[model samples]
Target: MRQDKPELRNLSEPVRFKRALALLLMTLVLPGSAQIVAGSKKAGRYAWRVIAGLVAIVVFLVLLSLVWRSGTINLIVSPTTLRIVQVLLILLAVGWAALFVDAYRLGRPLTLERNHRLTASILDGVLVVLVMTVLIWSSTIVSAQRDFVASVFGNGEKSKADKGRYNVLLLGGDSGANRIGVRPDSLTLASIDAETGRTVLIGLPRNMAKVPFPAGTEMAKQFPNGFEWDGCGHDCYLNGVYTWAMGHKQHFPGVKEPGLVATQQAVEGLTGLKVNYYVLIDIAGFQHLLDAVGGITVDVGKKVPIGGIGGPIKGYIKPGKDQHLDGYHAMWFARSRAGASDYERMTRQKCVMTAMLNQLSPQKVLTKFQGIASASKEVVQTNIPSGELGTFTDLALDSKKLPVSSFSPVPPLIKTGDPDFELIRAKVAEAVGKSEALDKGSDDGDGKKSGTPSSVSPTKKPSTPGKTPSKPSTDVDDVAQVCKA
Candidate 1:
């Protein structure tokens, strides 16, 4: 037989009001706890079971994520998981809101005086609104994540690290109305340690002539000597390989992006580092990413021209300390070649990359998630499997704490016009060797010298002429120091 809690109903106005708040807090913390203590045991036990099941599920997920990081990451990106979570959030919000109302009923609100009813009613209402608002907001963010993942990342095969490092070819594309396909203006091989996320930014000068193609690839057979076909005029340089490959797509049968494939192979051939993946970001769209992050602060060592590469000079990102560049000027700052050497611009680009990588945080991403996600869909294109996002995300967080090293074949070292392939490879090996040494030093200091180890900030100095302390004869270490103004 069911019986009412006469004591609860017979309470004085002050006591009833206090009981109402206590019941509400109990419901907020554990949905069925208040019911078990004061309301129907049958109903409370059922709700208790449901709440217990939910708690167990959450605990299991947390444990799984800690044990199998990649699997948890894959689950997060999976459409099925996202949709299920979305549906569950809606259902939970509805059910929990109902539970709060039931808790109000259990509080015996109607028996209280009018003013007391108003106060308790208002408290219950606020709790319900807060829960619903937060859950709905969460669902919206999850939906955004689903859309972003679906649009940007394909279910491609995962790539493994080569000798404990991922060598990704990052190409800055200049696909304007006047351009044919996407021709690269900046080429860099980002060699990152799989464990520590230590990176070496190997900058390939845009004017670097005679870029090599990997052996046995169709491009190798086509160009025989290098990426230097005589009839193409100035398009024979490394940056022009994309357009040339696009034009000769017939040679790369079944390839969706022959240009990208050719450029990857060329980088592999030049650096002697196997290219695992390629990220092509259209420089024109690069502005949105910066804008999304509220722009980056840089030390402008020299005047960077805007819209005057081969036309009339419209403006200049004048020399200054702590210069904040919006998307528009940031784009020009990275791509501007007017009154600046190609190498100088590459140095500036490095500074920007370092800044973006370090300054971006999980909190910032969450706050400006919509803008960043929208920008990424438009500006970034890559073959990296979405499943590996967790691994890379972890690495990026780790990388923020370390200094970034760079190697560029400029004057006094290997001239861009006639780069010595052997010398370029040798210098690459030396720079990588230095990074390895740095890893060893760090490990020794941190008390883990046994393991074979591998592995950016905004606005710290800008080297003169945008020249990183990189002498043609010497490698540059910690680009942030070189560019922090």
Candidate 2:
């Protein structure tokens, strides 16, 4: 009987160790399961209830998203909701970690063998780390979304598309401390077809003078003869509209973004397209954004200088077919005007945009989401509402498959200094018509001839004066091809 008793004790030690290990694993899988099996019933019940509530909330959010995606996105992106979610994630991490520790305790780990006890400690450490990592990651994403919402979106009435196309004016400028005010050095109108996602990039020159405003508007009333008013002699240029309007803010009563508003009006009047929204990007901040996305690759057509106008010359980006550019180098590549004209700089900027659109793949975006989100908030400002973001996102994805075409009103096409509005409208109409036909041809599966222009070649230099501009040399053969190289 004495020998049997010792044997039974030995057997019971192994059984206890196995039970403890089982309970710890169960708790790891289902937060309250181990507690219910071995620990206090009351604690297990509370944890189960909390888990159930979280699951219910998630299910409800999913359903809501399916029914009304825009509303759900707006609610999620709201600053208040982001803060609440961040706090909840932190609380969840703490609560989950505590439950894990309790699960280890319920297993009676202290009574196990030395090896078993060490194993339990290791398991406990892993559980805490894994749970906390997920919660913290979610919290960081929420914070980034909040900052993006607050910095980028502005309180502006959303405008409807005109003739099945949404025209968005994109402005890029240097907002450095040395600059007097925001002077939009580069302006491009991204006119996207609502259904087909066909895009036409319309580039406008910065030094273009005599810019007209939409008739019957306050700006038109102020400058009936164009942006060149009585006092504004040489300062009345297309890019100067923003700074000029800002200086005369009293003229635009009850307007929040008078500068952008004025610029939009000017672009709309020039392009003969109704402008729906505007996105302003600070050139300096754009560098940081590029760095966040691991930089971008572009085809450098010519030798571009780096930092010469204001500061000393830093370096030069040598001409190459496929050049990978970091943030600093990329900024100079887009903005440098040392030996190049503004027209050439405009083309380079368009190339940069094309590269970004094509090269910023989904994998890169997901991996570098945090950095990208934070940098975007600093560099970008727009009146695009949070509610419409999903729709635009879908359109942007659709556009990737379609070819992008560009039209610039520079020399050999349309004179920028004294542009003929009628001629500009005709060119815009022709470009849009060709894009629509191409998209239609693609949809019809006509592989032989998809309405794509043979004259469009990215490598062709602009035709000199006296030559017929029937097919200007400064046309994009395939924006995708240029970007991919």
Candidate 3:
């Protein structure tokens, strides 16, 4: 056997203990640091390279997120990128743990006093376990995010912005447990500015009759005069488009979801705006999403009935100022049709949507991302691609500060029994144009009012400038005006 090292045999207990603690501390702060000071320069060089690479990666990501947010999001959602990151994290854990072990070795543990040696061993072991566990946990979350994106967005067709705007159709899909096909109970077209994220919400009543379709599309060819059919005898309302299309998907070949596609066409034709994407929300699963963001605060104008659409009223979400509602109550608040008319329910639904958008923050999303993503995967089906998620994500953040403008083709404006498609389209165009002007005015510090309703001219005053209007809910010029209060 080789002779024992002379330094180890000669060192005092205090000196040895002090040296051991110093090595462990330095290694904990900067891996391979202890080795460079005392042991293998070769291993230390490798660690320094790793540290440099990690620093470079962090800097690059920071810049990327700032300059090209969508690219950053694409990487995060890409399964390939996530898988590579997972492997790298595993390697990093092992290499980092090895450095700690090596740092402890450089301390020459054999020379330490029994108590001091035990203490150093314990600390080094704890650090290794802690660091490894954290990285592994992070890797697991990355996996979860990947799965969530895959399940929710799927491989939907990407749509281009039309006239520098994105028109997305939002439908509240009502598919009963016993129903054959889903019916779109609620309909709203969200026409968003591609660059500014300023939005115009155009609400279409479910009972709107004889909606037109695009000129060359299958829906138009099938019903050239508009969305008309003898089966319902022109009583073929807008909501029935989904059920009708689902029962006849054969006509819509190459379409993954004929019901959704047909509905998109109808909305596009009726509004004269190109539909870029469609989000079909399952009504029953909506509660889970509301709960994930820790509930929302809404002004309940009247007593909202619960469990009364087809049965006895179980309870009431009492009217109050600034009421905070949980998932269950919020869902019922949007769905209940007991004492309220369908149009009233539609307005309430819009209010709920506006409140959620205004209140949901990046901090909340980050903290509750796992829950939100899980609920979203179940609650939503959409044609929005995963690639544009980052762009929309940024837009959503920008929208939180701005107001949302809305228009609904309801009475005092148009007849739902026999809608004026041409007039409706004109109103839609006017609403969008005024919203754009509103955005421009805000930029030039000239515009303060939101998009005016079709009935209200921009020159006309909404209410007294100083006082809040009591019935802002009826006009719905600035959705934030009513929903926020």
Evaluated with lDDT, which candidate comes out highest? 1
- Candidates sorted on TM-score, descending: 1, 3, 2
**lDDT comparison, 1 vs 3, better candidate:** 1
Instruction: Give me the runs in candidate 2 sitting further than 4 Å from their true place.
Output: 1-15, 40-75, 229-234, 440-477
Position 307, candidate 3: lDDT: 82
Query: Candidate 1 on 348-408: residue-level lDDT in tens?
Result: 8888898888778889998888898899999899998777777777778778888888888
Put down candidate 2 lDDT per residue, 399-420, tens digits, no spaces.
Answer: 8777777877777766777878
* Candidate 3 per-residue lDDT over residues 213-283, each given as its tens digit: 99998888888987776778534789988888888889988776798988999998888899999899988
Model 3 spans > 4 angstroms off: 1-11, 231-235, 441-476
Using all chains and alpha carbons, the TM-scores for the candidates as numbered come to: 0.89, 0.84, 0.88
Answer with 2 or 3, whichever has the higher lDDT. Answer: 3
Candidate 1 ranges with C-alpha deviation above 4 Å: 1-4, 46-72, 441-474
Instruction: Please give the RMSD to the true structure for each candidate, in Å.
Output: 4.3, 5.8, 4.1
